[model samples]
Target: MTEPYHIDTSSNWRRQAVEDWLFGLDHLSPGMREKVVTAWVSAWASSSHERLEDMPFSPGENPYRLMDHVNDVTRAGLDLGARAAADWKVEFDPEVLVPILILHDVDKPLIYGREGNAGVHAQLFHELPHGVIGGMLLKELGFAHTIVSTVATHATNAPFHGRNLEAHVLHYADLFAADHAFRQMGKTPLYLRHGR
Candidate 1:
């Protein structure tokens, strides 16, 4: 049997810091949670950003922090998923949903740089979309196909929007987070913008 991938978060300040944002996912299995945290910490370790909070939601002068958006998406997903389950009697697994939400933007750290120079490395070494990179990482780390595929297709611009319940919930949750952030910043929401 293959050994589970593990990282000693206690020894590294960076891993602990990243784990803070991932605290509320007890709904996920320990192995899945470890993989999710592992992905985030690994991305941070590979990137130029000194901290998880240093990564931005987008590449430009955007004010949204990547983790903030991720947390927002997760919360919104839970709320929406609950409502859908209660109202429409649809079934979805939180185990699948939560990890995908947490790791959906796992590539942000790698794709972006420090505050002043974000996306510089992206223009060169990281050309893939954040979703694609994240999906690739999760796959390399042995995540389930459902989780990996959902993370891969969760991007708004992804060619194949997934057909599963978790994918649908994640898609709207991500949109909800970004829309709220953009509106709060007094810019037009991405869904409302043209030439996307």
Candidate 2:
């Protein structure tokens, strides 16, 4: 059976969130897998943010929580990677891709401010950006170089992207997820939405 790429949150979304992340990390070797799990838990515990719902889908949109955005991207990326391999004969390292998927947008809370329930990116981010911030944070937490590189470059259309196939996959995957979030919001008129 094929694993799902998208999650529709139930009442127990938090436990389901853990399961979703673990699914992405399942491709890693045992040691690295343990390390990722440890860091993920540590980051969540140590983070100043209270809940994923506080973070917006983007600096401009809040159709969903930051958690929703990351989960969507991870699922999309994994599915895209699989299709790329089977349909096009292009292959990427799943070990490399999974960590990148998990960490790619994890810095939304750190790089943006919580004004109520929305993520408003700081002025610094217009220059330095979340990909850079997220990369630095993950590296300090003791991630490998490839994962760092991939996370740091995964921003859509950022300069560091397109440097390699892994980066390309991540960049496009982010776009796909962001588009998904925006479309969800698009169901209602923008004026009716809370965020402008």
lDDT of each: 0.76, 0.65
Error of 2 at 105 (Å): 1.0
Candidate 2 residue runs with Cα over 4 Å from true position: 1-23, 42-46, 122-127, 187-196
| Cα deviation of 150, candidate 2, in Å | 1.8
* Residue 172 lDDT, candidate 1, scale 0-100: 88
lDDT tens digits by residue: candidate 1, 52-160:
7688777666667888988898888888889999998988777787888888888777666655743344542345765777777788888889999989888877888
Q: How many clashing residue pairs appear in each of the predictions shown?
A: 0, 0
Number of the predicted model whose TM-score against the real structure is largest = 1
